[model samples]
Target: MPGKLTITRKISYDTFVQVMEKKGAPDSLAENIIAQRKYTLSKLDRRFVKELLFGSLRWYAKLYWILQKTSNRDLDKVTAQIKTALILGSYQIFYMSKVPDRSAVNESVEYIRYAGQANAVKFVNGILRTISRRAEYFPKPDKNKHPSQYLALQYAHPKWLVDRWSKRFNFERLKIILNANNQQAPNTIRVNSQKVPAHDLLNFKQSILREDKNTVYNKSLATCLVLKDSPNLEIGSQFAEGKYTIQDGSSQLVGHLVQPKEGEYIIDACVGPGGKSGHIVELSKGKAKVTAVDFSLAQINKAKTNLLRLGHDKIEFVCQDFLDFTPTQKPDKILLDAPCSGLGVLRKHPEGKWLKSPRIVHNMARRQQALLKHSLQILKDGGEIIYSVCSFEEEETIKQKEWLEREYKDAVSFPELSTRLPENYKYLLTKENILLILPGNKYSMDGFGAFIIRKNESVSNCRQAK
Candidate 1:
């Protein structure tokens, strides 16, 4: 007998498709849903919702590959709504253990009916039943083919991405990167020393999960605390208390790279949601004249909310594009956490494989170039600038670094990263002043890159540096 439908999970699955099919990233889509309170979901309900939604979208490429084999014609010929039903059904059939196979097929057919795809009911049932057989439904990837093709099929990742990694990473390492992206990332938070010390957080009355076992690395981070198996810190009581900000280890390193001193004027150009800006304030002991700016008013508002929550009263927020907005005064230090293809955080945003590509990577590089060039205009001649992106694409990292060094020549100098990053992070440096973070178990950090350059004081007339 078939189990009764898990209606909430069904609803969640549909919404996930509604948003993700249009290319919405899971995090933002979930946030919008939660904020709107479209339905009252228990914690477990929300978890299942996320599980089904993320799982289907995360393994999109491979699941579609499965569907294509099970179908007579190309998958492109399938209607979007029916196709989503198939993907949802396939996720439970192959990936989910708790969902009984019968329940998976039955519940999916129910979704098809609810979607008003009564015509697809038999089609959905046939495909799902065939796939539920476990052996016959999913296609076996042939390893004898090129490693890129095998990895791409095995991991459900885009072929281009697989090909790109295969060339740079050995087969074993590439597999690690692909697998890690499919795993749940740790919930790491940096304690806001300006508001409360790490020790004080222990007594905050919230259910504290175990601290990261690597106490030495945790200590080396100064105030960062690693949490596993904890509630979403984004809305947890501790987060509300402004005790800490949820940030990735690699991103937190960007603050370390900035290494802002007391009384220095710093610009967090492109401060999205304000994670790094808050770190800057905390690092400077709230003494740095921090100006946080972003092009989007929405992003600027997020920066403001984070700054307010973290209890900083001194920073100024600006909702203006850094490319066009001229600063009142040249900042002594600038951190351009410029946007890029976000290739580094794929573990967090699995849809990236479907939503982003090499073309987007090249386009972002051009935008980053423009942002970097314009940012130099507002920095003091001798001031330092940190150009960082959450991408390891050569164009965004090394190529951009090369471009800056070429454009500035004697006017700009690249520093060695070892001089700034902690000992554990020094190995991440490819040169004196750049950090290319690889995603996976190594550091469990995102794929990120950063370059620090100092404007030449001798070129003080500096308009020529333009």
Candidate 2:
């Protein structure tokens, strides 16, 4: 007999519906929604809610495709409640092998009734049952004729994104990235040197391993750790005591590229949530004068709270647009972690595949160009700028680099780029001296593109370097 809707599953369903209705980032919105629940959920309950919510969003397109094949009704025409219930049920049925199909179908049926759509119970249940029966042999677009559509449905990405990527990579490489985006992202963290050196953290090996079985220190980057199978952390004593903060390995590399030094001032132009800013302060041992700037006051406050928790309250936080903001003195170095398509972090933020469009990428690239140009104005002579984005798109990465080189005669690649990196990481540098970490790389890092350019004593303008 099918069980009634459990509290955990109900919360997951409610959160999923809210995300769909609001069309907000699932990760962000789900956090706020779940936090508002009056009753405290168990650890397993929290994990189930996140898995169900994120997994449904992660494989949304593919689930919808399966439903369209399995059902006679047009999903778009169905009520939002019915559609979301089906997708959630189908996700568990197709991708979550641990979840029995009967439970998947029954819970969805119960959710529809729970949501006051008792009429949808039979409809959702019938479709989910049909999906389970035909799970192995669902229809797909013909690969040869509709390659983009085929890959989009097969990989659960937007067709336009798949089409764009298809042009830049071979079939095998494209598949690799698509497959990588679908896999679970690792819980990588950067150990706070101020509190506990990464090596010392490892010395607590028996305790660390006991807490997280899948944890491993990253040899190439001493301050980095990869917790392969753990969920996000909030209650851990290590995190509470500011020993480490969760940050992607690729993102951690940006601070390495900055190479903060004592007495030097650094500016993070678009310091969203201040991860790099915190890392810079840690790396400089609280000696570097850093100014973290962002346009949104909310983001500034969030960064302030986060950094204060990390025990670095000396750093300045400025809530102003990078283009208009200026410090009392020019910064020795500037980091432009510009906003882009976020194509590189699909594994972690799967909603981007559906929410983002190519137009958004082009718009972000234009903003990146503006930020890059302005960063040079506030940087001291002979100082370098570390430009990075969590995307590998041509317009946002290489094209921006080309534009800077063409427009500024004094802009030159950082001479010591190769030597600054660890020997194992030297291969990440490209022929143009850009640090390009494509998705699906062996490091299991998010795709990131970064390059360093130094300013000459007398900045010059060139018309034709392209």
Candidate 3:
């Protein structure tokens, strides 16, 4: 009983196309596919799959423009599968130079044929072959003639994003920012100082202290380890033993800004997934009475798991919206790592560049202002609030700072915490004493902005006396 002439056995191209269309967000799509195939596919095949999926989406706009130019057809009228095939093929030719041109073209032609687009098969083949022959002849605006076009093609970013950045920053500096955005981010982990000393973690054999003088990760912490790449640190026996928790170097610094001390009461407003909360508990040697609160039940559940894994049982997890939640006891210190559009973390989440719009930033700013107002209400007199976001947008960082000053007036004062910062970071503080960690800055810190706001003791006294 021979199998009846089985011909095709590989994972279908249509399956990949379906996944991308369903996920919409490119990174999530790639991650979803990788997770699904992890048990079934070989590592080499997985790498190829990742490359094809990401490369197609990464260069989608440029590839489509080339398709429009070469085919002399409106890309809007193209069928979904055809468009996907063309993009997948053109990406290999332009970006994956190791792939043979004939193979890429032929495979794409076969894919189109399988999808019952036999008539368009010749159309796809001819256009791709033409592009192969005259790759340099595609229409591209000159740098002098069209600065937006130049930036879009040169950096492989959406034209709208390039236009916005060009207006916001100097053209030369924007180039550096864009280049950084496209690079792979380093993995950063914060030592759980409660269970294990930071110095001991540094002395561990698995890590190498980043020697880059410009890295904030190097200067800010007692010990910061930047792995050469993202690896499964959590799966290791050391991590399970509560040695350290994986976190971005910039994010880990937020706990330092809050500066919780032994036996103090701290409130982690909006503490979903509990990275900062865990770090705070660890830093305080488990003596700080920390209440971690968030609006999302799902995130709170995950935070609970993380806290348990880190062996942090003293901290309390409350599932309530910070805007509406009330504290049973006044917090000696509070941290509001507010929800943001996350523009500052483009290097880590490149898909965000395409998915987010300017309107989202505006809307998020409003929510952030409201959250900060509520966070200020729960702080004890003389308590400090660390308001932070992983975003560089002026609306989220600087504008929120201005709003806090104008609204809170004498009740809230920006503390001069820069003195505590390493000597090299003195320049990052504004005249008002707010900190702005810009991407591509001298520190190479993840784009983070945080301001330490201390409640005036006199105001606290007056409220308490009333």
- lDDT on C-alpha atoms for all candidate structures: 0.79, 0.82, 0.72
Backbone clashes in model 2: 0
lDDT (Cα, 0-100) at 27 in candidate 1: 59
TM-score rank, highest first? Answer: 2, 1, 3
Ranking by lDDT: 2, 1, 3
- Give per-model CA RMSD: 3.1, 2.5, 5.4
How far residue 357's Cα lies from its native spot in candidate 2, in Å, is 1.2
State how far residue 172 of model 1 sits from its true place (Å). Answer: 2.2
Model 1: residue 147 alpha-carbon error in angstroms: 1.5
> Model 2, 25-87: lDDT tens per residue?
776776676677775777677778778888888899988887887888888999888988899
Q: Write the per-residue lDDT of candidate 1 for residues 28-83, one digit (tens) a residue.
A: 77657666766666767777877888788779888888888887767687777778
Q: How close is every model to the real structure, measured as TM-score?
A: 0.92, 0.94, 0.82
How big is the positional error of residue 252 in model 3, measured in Å on the Cα after superposition? Answer: 1.9
Question: Which residue pairs of candidate 3 clash?
Answer: none
Ranking 1 against 3 by TM-score, winner: 1
* Candidate 1 Cα misplacement greater than 4 A, ranges: 1-7, 33-37, 137-141, 198-220, 230-236, 458-466
lDDT of 2 at 387: 91
Clashing pairs in 1: 415-432, 415-433, 416-432, 416-433, 417-432, 417-433
